[model samples]
Target: MSSLLKPFSISDGPCESGAFRHGVGCSKSLHSPAFDPTISHGATAPGCRTGTTRTRLGCTPGIYHTYSARRTLAAASTGGRKVTHPGKAILAGGIAGAIEICITFPTEYVKTQLQLDERANPPRYRGIGDCVKLTVQDHGYRGLYRGLSSLLYGSIPKSAVRFGTFEMLANPMRDETGRLDNTRSLWCGLGAGMAEAILVVCPMETLKVKFIHDQVSLAPRYRGFFHGVREIIRDQGVRGIYQGLTATVLKQGSNQAIRFYVMNSLRNWYKGDDPRGEMHPIVTAVFGATAGAASVFGNTPLDVVKTRMQGLEAHRYSNTVDCAFQILRNEGPVAFYKGTVPRLGRVCLDVAIVFVIYEEVVKLLNNVWLTD
Candidate 1:
C-alpha cells in the first residue's frame, strides 16, 4: 500500500528514496545548482520532467537544459508567449544581417544590374554569365560589389527592425492555445515588412539602385554612397530618398508574409504540438530557402516597379501605378521578371544564412543571459 501511495506523494515531498522530486534521477536534483528563476516549467507539461528540467533527447544528461533554453526563446519569438524581449531580437537580427550582407551583396548587385538593363538601350550583356564576363572586362571584378556600402547601411537596420517587430507583434495575436497560426504569422510578417520599408529600405534602396544603375555610364555622377545620397538630397530633396515608398511597402509586406507563413507552416508540420521545436540546421536552411523562393515569385512584379521608381531616371515615371504600366507597355511582361534567376538564388541563400545565423545567435544569447 505504501508503494501504491508513493506516486501521489510527488506533488508534496521527496519520495521514500529520500531524494528531491525532479527529473528522472531525483537524487541528482539535490546536488545541482539552485533553480534558475528565469525559466518557467510546467509541472505536468508534455515531454518535461518535474520542476524546470526537460527530457533531453537521445538519453543525454545536461543537453536538455540547453535545448530547453533554445526552445523557450524560439517559442517567445514565434508567438507562443504573450510578449518578447525586443533588445535580444534586435541584437540577434543586426548581427545576422551583418553576416549575411558580406556574403550575398555581389549577387544582389548582379540582380539589380540585370533588372535595370533593357534591349531598347542596346543591351550591354547577353545573359548572366555574359553580364559577369563583360562587367569584369570593363570594370574589373570589384564592379560586382559597387553598391555594397549602401546595402550594408540599409540591411542592418532593416533586418533588425524586421525581426524585432515581427516578434513583438506575433505574440499578441497567438491563438487561444498560444499557437501561432498562419494568419497570425502573416500579420506579424506584414507589420514588420511595412515598418522596415518606411524606415530604412526606401532611402537605402534609392541610393543603391541609383549607384548600380549608373555603373554603366563612362562618367558616373554618383562617385560613392554618401556622395550619391548628398546629390539626391541636393537635387531631388529628401523626398528623392523615398522614391519608391509605395512599391517598397507592397513588395516587402508581401515578401515577409509569404516567408513567415511558409516557414511557420513547415515548422509546425514537423513539430505537431510545438511549432518552435528544434530541427537540424540543414532542415532549417532548407525551410528558409523554400520560403525565400516563394516570396520572390509572389512579389517580383512589385520589385520591378520599386527598382524603376528608385532608379536615377525615376523622373520618367510618375508613381507606382505609372511605373508598372510603363514597364508593361514598353518593356513587356518578361521585363517584370528580368532578374528572377539571380534574385531567386540571392534570396534563397540569403534567407537560409540569415535564419541559421539568427537562431544560433539567439541560442548563444540565451546561454549568456538567463532571461534574454
Candidate 2:
C-alpha cells in the first residue's frame, strides 16, 4: 500500500483544470488485497487538470492518464503577447491613408474628371487618356495633383478617426462568442463612415472637388489650399465646406459598411480557427482588393451624386435629391455610373495597397512599442 501510494505523491504542477480517471481494478484475491502502482500515479495531459486524490484502495495494474481540456486562445492574443496598445488602429490607418493618396492620386484625378464632365455639353475631353493628356497639356503634369494638399491634410485625421471609431464600435458590438460578426462589422463601418463624413471627409471632398473641377488658370479664383478654403467659407460660409454633406454621408456610410463586411468575411474565412492569425502581405492585398471592388460597385452612384453636389456649381441643384433627379433626367441613368472603369481600377489597387501597408505598419509599430 505504501509503494502503491508513493507514485501519486510526485509533485507535478498544480492542475487548474483536467479530468482525472480513477481506474480501480481490484485483483481476485479473496483473502488479501492487491494495489496497482500504475493507477496511483496519474499522468498529466496537455490541457487536463486533475485534483490531488490520495486513496489507499486496492486495484489491478491498470494505466491511468489525464485527459486535458482544449485550451482556446482569446481573440486579442497574438503569438507574442496580448494586444495592449490602443493607438495601433490610428497609426496604421493614418499611414495607410497617406500612402494611398500619394500612390493613387493620379487615378483619382482622372476619375473625377470623367465623373464631372457635363453630359449635355460636347464634353471637355474624349475619354480618360484624352482627359489626362488635355490636363497635362493645359496645366502641365502637375495638374494631376491639383487637389492633393486638401486630401493630404484631411486623410490622416479622416483615416485615424474612421479606424478608431471602427475599433471602438467593433469591440463592444462583437458577438457573445467574442467574434466580430458580419452584422456588427457592418454597423461598425457605418458608424465610422458617418463619423468621418461629418468631421473630415465632407470638407476634404468639397475642397478636393473645388480644386480639381475649378481648374486654375494664371489668375484663378481659388489660388491654393488655404485660399480655396477661405473662399469657400467666405462665399458659402462654413456650409460651403460641407456642400455635399448628404451625398457624402450616403457614399461614405455605404462605402465602409460594404468594405468592412466583405473584408471581415474574407479575413474570417482565411483565419478559420485563429482570429489573430497573421496573413501574408499578398493575401491581405487580395482581400483588400476584393473588399474595395465590392464597395466601389455598391456606392459608385452615391459617389457620383456626392461629386456633383460638392462641385463649385452645386448651387444649381437644391439638394441631393434634386441633384440625383437632374442627373437621371438630364444625363440619363448611365450618368450615375460615370467613371466606373477608372474608379474600379483606382479603388481596387488603392485598397489593396492601403491594407498591405496598414497591416505592415501596425506590425512594425507593435514591435517598436513592444505592445503586450
Listed per model in order, the count of residue pairs whose N, CA or C atoms clash below 3 Å is 0, 7
Poorest stretch of ten by lDDT in candidate 1:
55-64
For candidate 1, lDDT tens digit of each residue in 1-372? 777766332324544332444575454332222245444332434554543443333222232354446556766666544334677788889999988999998888888888888645888777788888888898899998899999998888988999999988887676644568887898889999999999988888988999898888778888888888888799989998999899999999999999999987887788787654578888889999999999999999899889989987789988899989988988899899988999999999999998888888877887686663
Give candidate 2 misplaced runs (Cα > 4 Å): 1-85, 175-178, 216-219, 370-372
Q: What is the C-alpha RMSD of each candidate to the true structure, in Å?
A: 10.5, 9.5
Question: What TM-score would candidate 2 get against the native?
Answer: 0.78
lDDT of 2 by residue, 1-372 (tens): 766666342222242222222355322211111244544454323333332223344332223222111112322343422232448888888889988889899889999988888798778778899988998998899999999999999988988888878887786665544468788889989999999999999999999998888783345687899999888888889998989898999999999999889998998789887766779999999999999999999999999999999987798999999999999999999999999889999999988988898789888887787644
lDDT of each: 0.80, 0.79
